[model samples]
Target: MEKRNQKRLDKKMLSHYQLQLLDDEDKRSVFLIKLTPLNSLLFFTFFMILITTLIFLGLKYSPLKEYFTSPTVENQAAYKNQLLKLNERILELENNLEANELYIKSIQAVVSGNIKAEKVDSLVVNKFHLNPDSELFKPSEEDSLFRIQIEKEEMEAMKASKNTVPDAKYFTPVKGFVTGKFDLTEKHLAVDISAGEGDVIKSIADGDVLFSNWTPDAGYTLIIRHANDIISMYKHCAKVYKKQGDMVKKGEAIAQVGNTGELTTGPHLHFELWVQGKAVDPEEYIDF
Candidate 1:
């Protein structure tokens, strides 16, 4: 009876082991793990949520906030200041360039334009100091216009002492066709004639050589003083035959025609007649 009972117990343990090994959909074993696909998905979702939350909180309180705001808030002020300063500097430079351009233009005009200024020790171009608020810059009685009147008065005073002939007999210093006629209203006191270079220049009447020298305007000039306060001026000559103190006879060869003066345009002679210190028309006495 003991052996029979031992055998029956052994058979019963074997059947229980087989039953635990087989999968049962209806009746699962209690006190045993029951893992499935749904359980795994739930676990993974919880882990992901916890990790994401931890990361978001860590970054929110860190230096990441300042890093993001730097380009918009702190740096913007510096960038704007730099940009504005650059614009202002460019504008100032542009203004300076314009002023320089105008100055260059004025210099060019002065260089190219020509004027036969009178040969006297007059004032050359120089800067004059004047108040910006003064009337000297304006045109009026007390301004440049008025100053011009004062200058004209001064000119008259000086001219009163200058030697000008008005009534001397007109003489053709050179034999040539009249290149230019006299215009009285224009204050042209001389007549121009086209003469051959080195041609003989004859004195119109008896006179004493007053001056024989090179001038800026009259070129190589010869001035003769005659009786009755009569004077004659011969300009644009190559050679002066008489000296300053030499007396010359009428129709005598006194000089050679040439273009020597700064005012001469070409080979020509400029002749002037004066009596009583005033200019007289050359056409009145000479048949040119």
Candidate 2:
């Protein structure tokens, strides 16, 4: 009896349980699996370890990690970059506004003839404040070439001044009688010459036609730019023979006399001369 009991205990320790699948009606076993107590414990332990490892891998590498991260911290870097760009744009706009204001003030000064000599001197000094002895301020090859050209021009101008004639030669635009004269006080900056209708008018000098257009006050008008900063204007014309930008020779026919514009009472030519932006008496330079 003692021996049999010991045998039974050993068999129980190594015993395997049989798992069987059987047809319900025939009661015949179709599949079977055997698992000992130790084998079952090992299989369960391996499955649990595998499941834990898979869960850890998914959280580490997949998008599920986003849920655990703080969104504000992640977006803060992007926001900082945008803020930096905005600041740069604001600075650029401020600089542009300041430059435009300075330009407008300069134009106003020129138009009102209020630009002071001190202002000009200050501008020059401020623009050229760099030390002349510095290597960075030294002239390049291009600058040397430009300086030579300017010096040559200055020499030519000096020679021309030495040989300058007492009177400048100018062709009479037309043979007519003067009805109105230049008077700065009255704001009549031009001379009105009366002649027969359709009388041919000529250019006083070789120049490029700057303007050729019609206006309610001047009617058909033409302006020419010549050398030495001289400009001539012809107004109240019956017809213009040249277009804007056309090169005209001295004594070339340019227009015809006419009684046009609201200010005219009869057929006449209104001619004006400008030297360096100031209106001058045309009779002083050219005969009617």
Candidate 3:
């Protein structure tokens, strides 16, 4: 029997090695592979790079990417929370818009006369649903007397006020011949006073300017709210010297006469006097 022997590896073997595949019949080399320390290291590096590239491409483009990118419970909950907040915000905006629309509608109703202004006073009275005949609301004898006395005083004051204005107290707004008079049949509620162009128009009484703006039919117009529930309207002016909310005294120059409105035939002032919301004859109040 022959004994087998094993070879020892040293520095020379670690440095370089070779492998060969030979033909069994002639012992001729069919394939040859050479290996070295540096060559082995370069091959291992390239192999690792290829493997890593394959793994990276699979994760980036394949369905297996969902394992890392798909939403978990916490992520889904966060997204749902954001959606709920957005929904709540939208609902809040909708509510605010509805409230604003209702408010605008109420104002339009009042302005268009669909809701009577006097009915608003009734709302205040009806709020508590208390009957006027209730004992708690009944007036005593002294209260009745006091109310009567107050009413008498108010009547006397009104009478005195009427006389005070009739005695040349109201300043004439313009000095001009009347081309148009207050005629209810013609629906001419305002008095048309014809004057030269650029004539300074004055206020008839001490008041605050309620409106000073241009209208298509009335042109440059100014309206003043005076004491004792009196309102004066002056229309078809060339220029307005005062703006809305200005304070003016009697005979103060507020505008210039002009034929600027669509309703005007020539340079004139369309003057209107209203007392307690009713148009009255300006001739009765002013001597113009």
Candidate 4:
């Protein structure tokens, strides 16, 4: 009897426990399952491990990994590097802009005759230096040829102008008193002569009438082209007797003086002389 009782106890200890679902009032089992404690513990542990593994995989392989991991040091460093490069580019652009502004100001000063050509040449040579290996900035053979041709032309022009004499026998355009003189600083390139109304204005030299027209500023205007690149302009005329392309002698009647244009305050003639595309004092070449 003692041996049999020990065998039964051992079997009971090894048997699985009953798990049941029942109605509370009827006390009837609707579903049932049996599991040993060791098996149940093993199943719960495996299920928990599986759930943890799935969560880890989801975070690792998905966009949620950013939230789980620390921020990337490489990305931060790359962004900083890009910002630094942009700053450097900005600085370079600013430097280029400053250099360009200085160059433009120097050019303007040169054009206005405020600075000497020698000074401007020296400034250009000192300010701008071309890199030896830069293809775009280097001067080409064609450029050198063009520069040489320009220098040759300038030399030829200078030689032609060197021994030229001023015209001492230029005809008087009108008998009048000079009221306004040529002043380059004032931008008045012509001399204004006050004359009687309907006073005859004559051509200053033998030339072809280049322009004969009326303007709002100088009502009846005329321009004559003469030899040696000399040009004469007569403005504020009451009447013009010549037309464009008409040939006239040195003392031919070409116009009459009057306050005809909006710029004239009274009967006057505004006379201008141009030599080689530069405005000169008309009094220097013509007797009023």
Candidate 5:
């Protein structure tokens, strides 16, 4: 009986209710509403949802967004500084590489008789404050005596200057008739010798092979650096037996005659001689 009574009370609390308003003087009903527990619950849920949507939109589209989502000014500046340092490091590496390339080219120029080695020496000396006109370059009494002795010896042999032709004998590179002569005005700095195919080509003097490589205009080219600042070049060869830095004696076989380059017409050897950074007629110094 008690359980039944409690059930009846709960049902009555959950049941519908009526709300009304009446005109006080006219004594007439003006409005009325019937409300239920389910309707009240639905209204409360809708109000909560509307409040949540408003908060989300304010966060997404208002100035408050940056406060939560964007990086701080200090962090952005630090990143920019890191990028600048990286750029500076890359620039320094590029400059170093360029300097190294220039150094290598300068050495090659001296070896190939395109520039005097003394010029390089002078440049280095000047950089270190040891130029000829500097006080540090003044010779002492012993140094003066040594210079006098060396000059006297050179004078007696009729070889006072460094440019005097070396006493070393030159060997003919190939037995052939001249097809082209060295001409400075024509810019043909080498002589073309017409030889039979596969004829042996020899080194003219004792030297180390400075370069042996293929090029479009002078294929199978070989360059040698000899004593007394002299250089020899052989181009348009059928084959080469020596490589860079290999030493070859005078008359040693180094290559074979052939038409191997785009500049060639028939089987031949193109030979050039350079002394003291100047190209000279090979026939003047070598008997072909």
Candidate 6:
């Protein structure tokens, strides 16, 4: 066991640390160092994290951050909720749309003269295909409420009212000279067309005879209501051809010119036209 102050160093290996045995323990040598590569990697990772944090803070304070982040996570979450609500609303609207479509179809059929208008009224009254408790009608509107039976009667009457409309050709009621015009202030709702005494009075257009009667103001009156919202009246007639309900055509002799009615000045024909509860100028179309 040769030992000189413990161990000896080799001078040839100057670049490396030389360990010499101390006493009788040459196998036990020590070197003090903690310079592992892991420490370097740990430091580098730490530095990188700091840099990333700085960048995040900078971006958060920047004005352009709002533009980019607004449509991102938070915004996307809100948009998702909104989209769900919108989908629910759309489903509800689709259901209502289907019901409305059927209602419109029914109304169209009625308007086309296929189904009567009264049928529609009944459908509404009975809530046949509607929510009875819906907000579409308030309880206060009960005054306007009509039963299906009454509605049926109203509908029947309305259907009968179809007879009220007169044809377009029946717009003119006389073929004579206009001696007077319709004046509301004068209380004259008709025109006095002076025809030759005993001149043949023709039916202005096609219509069903409503009456062939005498009135105090209108001596011999013949009222005809035709289709298409038209009506004609002839007064001061000495004679009448067709009676009530007789379908007369235009130019058909219906009466003879005569001096009648308190307002009539001579043996002229008092002709008039009515439309929708109002009277207009008859000379607008008739050549005479």
- 4 or 6, which is superior by lDDT? 4
lDDT of 4 at 20: 99
Give the Å shift of residue 258 in candidate 2: 0.8
User: For residues 1-288, could you state the per-residue lDDT of candidate 2 as single tens digits?
Assistant: 999999887787679999899989999999999988768878999999999999888877888866775657658888898899999999999978776456434323422336532224121112225778999879999999999999788545533332132366889988899999976546677899988889999999999886787766677888787877677888889999999769999999999998777767889998987665455678878878
lDDT of 1 by residue, 68-176 (tens): 5446665789889999999999999997877645533332232222322222122123234568787655666567777888878855653443334345454566789
Question: Which of 1 and 2 is the better model by lDDT?
Answer: 2
lDDT of each model, Cα atoms only? 0.68, 0.75, 0.77, 0.77, 0.78, 0.64
Model 4 lDDT, full chain set = 0.77
- Highest lDDT against the true fold, candidate: 5
> In candidate 1, how many Å is residue 15 off?
99
Q: Identify the leading candidate in terms of TM-score.
A: 5
Candidate 2, residue 162: lDDT:
26
Off by over 4 Å in 5: 1-168
Displacement of the residue 187 alpha carbon in candidate 5, Å:
1.0
Q: Write the per-residue lDDT of candidate 5 for residues 3-85, one digit (tens) a residue.
A: 99998877875789887899999979899988777677788899999999998898789988767777679989998999999
Candidate 3 has a TM-score of 0.45
Q: How far is candidate 3 from the true structure (C-alpha RMSD, Å)?
A: 15.5
lDDT of 3: 0.77
Q: Quickly count the clashes in candidate 6.
A: 6
Per-model TM-score on C-alpha atoms: 0.42, 0.44, 0.45, 0.44, 0.46, 0.41
